[model samples]
Target: MLILTHTLHLNRPSGKVPIEIRLYQPLPTGASWICNFEIDWPEVRLARHGVGEDALQALVIALQVIGAQIYTSPYHEDGSLRAYDREDGYGFPVPSNLRDLLIGVDKMSF
Candidate 1:
């Protein structure tokens, strides 16, 4: 099992909110990599899972959900939720800075 830990900083209006993350990858031969992710915040304790060959992919998926929660949390500065228009006609709110942590790791192919 591959265990990874990270602390994410979300630049909120109030201040920089720190979130703790723990990711586990159990890569068994002949099977896809399954990742278990956990997030910790002052008022939120969340867990999620994803299956993918690359850890970054799983992290990305998990972050999407976590980001949504943070964006909509009462602690968020914007009283109203923010939305974005996509070319596919789907809309999504601005993601949290947790997603930004993957930028450097995303470029390298494992």
Candidate 2:
């Protein structure tokens, strides 16, 4: 069982929104593990972040990591979800066009 926890600070005009999570449910692939995810922590932030955009992308990228996928679990002890090979995620954020020059540049072509 591999659990991934993410923390973000949402600044809202009404008040400061705090403590959001991205939960990944682990799955078995062949003999190793894989993951799919759903959100379980805060409902309010979902209103602002809008599901299926930022949330799922973050979880997927985090798991298909280059060197490591094993991390600490953040779910409550009684959390009843289990991981599987396929991921059923909800609510992700649409991305902005702003590019980070430090990443994803094709150096050989340049």
Candidate 3:
């Protein structure tokens, strides 16, 4: 159970504020996600502000895309909301299954 963490920073060419996204897999969720399949993907996205169902669905989609065992987190009230950073910027632990979505997962200093 390696904790693969990454970050999401979606930027708009129009200069609009970028939408931060955080997505991970191997979630501790006891749902049927485990019996799905093996995930080789490496990128994830979160709701950040009000992505709503899209964000949540995106998580499940990402996981199901490759097939990962969702790890449940007692501290994770709403994993999607974790994308946006209230103080500075949004931050989320990158998941190996969704790391491909990240612009620069390896360059991430944090």
Candidate 4:
């Protein structure tokens, strides 16, 4: 099942590109909760997996991994154009954004 889906608008010289991220739950036969994720780029689609104890944990790991990929990518540099996370209503500040998303989780019993 698809757990989460978000679109990020990345700035390009020619125009803005829409990058979609989709996260899915682990398969029944999997040993652990494998968070499968896909990044739909303009020209290509990338897939990867993250292992966690639960669905929420898996999702967090997947997002952090993808965020690092974006931070080091050539698409982001010192430019007027910036990438925006439409769902979160914020720019690509990487770990900060990820941290903000997990604000309340830190205090949770889990």
**Winner by TM-score:** 4
lDDT-sorted candidate list, best first: 4, 1, 3, 2
Ranking by TM-score: 4, 1, 2, 3
The alpha-carbon root-mean-square deviation between model 2 and the true structure, to one decimal in Å, is: 15.2
Instruction: Give all candidates' CA lDDT scores.
Output: 0.50, 0.31, 0.32, 0.58
TM-score of 2: 0.30
**TM-score for all predictions?**
0.42, 0.30, 0.20, 0.62
lDDT of 3 at 36: 18
- Candidate 2: tens digits of C-alpha lDDT, residues 18-79: 44444455444454444453333345322111122344444454433311111112221222
* Better TM-score candidate (3, 4): 4
Candidate 4 stretches with Cα past 4 Å from truth are: 27-30, 78-110
lDDT of 1 by residue, 30-103 (tens): 55555677777667688777666665665565545555554556544433222212211012222445333222
- Those runs of model 2 whose alpha carbons end farther than 4 Å from true positions after fitting are 29-33, 39-60, 63-110
Model 1 pairs whose backbones collide: none
* Poorest 10 consecutive residues by lDDT, candidate 2: 98-107
Q: Please give the lDDT score at residue 55 for candidate 4.
A: 65
Taking every candidate in turn, the Cα RMSD to the unseen true structure, in Å, is 9.7, 15.2, 14.0, 6.1
Off by over 4 Å in 1: 1-3, 9-18, 26-32, 53-57, 77-110
Error of 1 at 103 (Å): 14
